[model samples]
Target: MGSVTELKAADGFKLAAYRAAPAGASKGGLVVIQEIFGVNHHIRSVADRFAALGYTALAPALFDRAERGIDIGYDEASVQRGIKLRAAIKLEDTLLDVAAAVGALKGAGKIAVVGYCWGGSLAFLSATRLPGLACTVGYYGGMIAAHAQEKPKVPVLLHFGEHDHGIPMTDVEKVRAARPEVQIFTYNAGHGFSCDERASFDKASHEQALARTLDFFGKHLKP
Candidate 1:
């Protein structure tokens, strides 16, 4: 249990992060990426949860580049602003921040990454482009639809809602086809089902996805 902080990425960009470490935590490192709403309480709590699991977890604020400390609710206007901020930043630059976070956890054993929504897409890219990560987990990344062709080079896990309107089954299947080596699962939920702050949060789906994610990290990112 600790406080939030900031770290410089590989490209000299400053990104905020929340780090949590548990007692006797020697399990591997996991970087919990944030959603479009920024690294708010939800994301920080996620880091704490991971720490309790006996793994060092860090959640980097990717939105720090576009707008530092931007935490908004899921209202219509907030969603629009979140989308705008998400789109304003380039994918490559975001990956660089992920790389820097990974570096910070270097020599701490194998590393894994878990991301949600927009961060989910970046998580996939992080596993593909960044070095040193043993595994990657992405949840309901709608933007990954456009980049399915960029297959992940590392062991990856993906979770999606079968009823997600923004990300259809066809797109999910395309991503599956593009990267058959990665594990993919579909649930009977909607977009942002993993986030409790969203209207679409589904507890069953969230629990199932978390179990699968932990299992995936256990297999590939075991320290």
Candidate 2:
């Protein structure tokens, strides 16, 4: 359902991406941002899911700037390594990679972005900074609070876990108060509730959030 492809950033940095296309005509395009773990199986599956929903989806390997081909599992050691790699790359650089992905999907029509965990925060930042986006969706983005003051240039949707230790409700409240226009939802779950590969995965919450996300994209990314 998907294949690995190469993308060139504006800075001439070449990175890898997993691209998935719809079986028939595409309704639009979707850019799926990856978690700190990189564009692993889960991220590729995410792209395939969106592709099945009639969008051309692309998941870029953002960690390529610091270290290429990074795909790790959900372990304490892997978490630490992902954090270090994420820190090594600058926000501007990450956006450049995201922009490259968005450019790659230009032919597929109106484009939207969806991300998880660290990628979630990047999705929000992409809405605020990047051009050619119809909307963006973010799930449990711990760093979003830091950028609450920045207004998004496009429609934004966000999901959060009520008990996520990494992202406090205070942070969600801050974002809500700062950006009242953004559609935000909370679930009775913990961090990584949407990822089945994680121990914190909650099927009920994931389903609800995914429904809302798809609806949002359908509304905004219409031809």
Candidate 3:
């Protein structure tokens, strides 16, 4: 249902991406951002899932700028490695990669971004910085509060885990206060609650959040 593709960013950097197309006409295009774990099996599955829902989905390898072919598991060592790779790349570069993905889906109708973990923060930044996006969704982004003051050019929806130690309620409140127009939801779970591969995965929270996300996309990404 998915295959590897290449995208050239604004800087002319070629990066690998996982592209998934729906069986029939596409409802819209979705740029699925990767968590710190890179465009591994989980991210590919995410893109395939969206494709099954009638959306042409693409997940770019943002870490390709640092090192090509980065796919790791959900372990502490992998986390540290992912962090190091993320640090090596700049935010601006990541957004460029995201823009390239949006460009790749030009004829798929309206485009939206959906991200998790570190990609979640990138999703918020994409809404604030990039153009041509219909809407954006972020799940458990830890760096959003620091940039909450920055205005988004499109509608934004955010989800957070109430028990996420990395992102406190204060941060969520700050985002809510700064961007009152953005829809925000909190669950009674811990960090990475939406990820089935994580110990903190919460089935109920993940399902509820996914439903809301799909609804939000449905309303905003209309053809």
**Residue-wise lDDT of candidate 2 within 1-223, one digit each (tens)?**
8999999999999999999999999989999999999999899999998888889999999999999999999999999999999999999999999999999998898999999999999999999999999999999999899999999999999999999999999999999999999999999999999999999999999999999998998899989
What would the per-residue lDDT of candidate 3 be over residues 18-49, giving only the tens digit for each residue?
A: 99999999999999999999999889998999
Residue 159, candidate 3: alpha-carbon lDDT = 98
| Model 1 ranges with Cα > 4 A deviation | none
Residue-level lDDT for 2 in candidate 1: 53
Instruction: Give the per-residue Cα lDDT of candidate 2 at 42.
Output: 91
Per-candidate TM-scores read 0.96, 0.99, 0.99
Candidate 2, poorest ten consecutive residues by summed lDDT: 45-54
lDDT of each: 0.86, 0.96, 0.95
Q: Lowest summed lDDT over 10 consecutive residues: which window, candidate 3?
A: 190-199
Model 1, 113-184: lDDT tens digits are 899988888888887788888989999988776887776778988999999989999999989888888789
Q: Which ten-residue region of model 1 has the weakest summed lDDT?
A: 144-153
Q: Give the TM-score of candidate 2.
A: 0.99
